[model samples]
Target: MIDLNNEKLELNYPCKWIYKIIGKNNQDIKKAVKEILDQREYVLKLSKSSKKGKFKSFTLELLVHNEDDRKMLYDILYNHDNINMVL
Candidate 1:
């Protein structure tokens, strides 16, 4: 078995990356993403919501030029006020 913690996963540069964002409001999440990614092309799709509808989730896909770009996007989303969780 491979030890994921000790191994690095190879990723091609300028590839598509997907982020799963969960938040209290879908519109708020979209707005936050738009504000951060302004002018960049991306795809956003509604993934799901809580049973009582208190929370929502979305799948955001975009092109990442390299590791820094991909990780930077994750940091931005993870630090956004409107976003509760990121994966």
Candidate 2:
């Protein structure tokens, strides 16, 4: 059996996770990443270093509320016109 009080306790704080965002261009990458961070109610920990190549990438660690919140974040990123890919 589960305790109602315990279940309520779990909902008190936001959950955190790391997301790696890969895109086609540097400007678009930064713009997309910033949009996600700014538009959502999340705390972001952006990667300081990224490998340089044909594609631009940034690793972002986010402290979100739950799985749904994460999915929303992904949806926003994926929908951005400047963003070609996200991982």
lDDT of 1 by residue, 11-62 (tens): 9899999999999998899999999999899999999999999999999999
Per-model TM-score on C-alpha atoms: 0.92, 0.62
Error of 2 at 70 (Å): 0.8
Summed backbone clashes in each candidate are 0, 0
Clashing pairs in 2: none
Each candidate: what lDDT?
A: 0.94, 0.66
Candidate number achieving the greatest TM-score relative to the actual structure? 1
Ten contiguous residues with the weakest lDDT in model 1: 1-10
lDDT by residue (tens digit), candidate 2, 1-87: 766764543443376666766666777677667765776544333444445565655666667787677778788887888766667
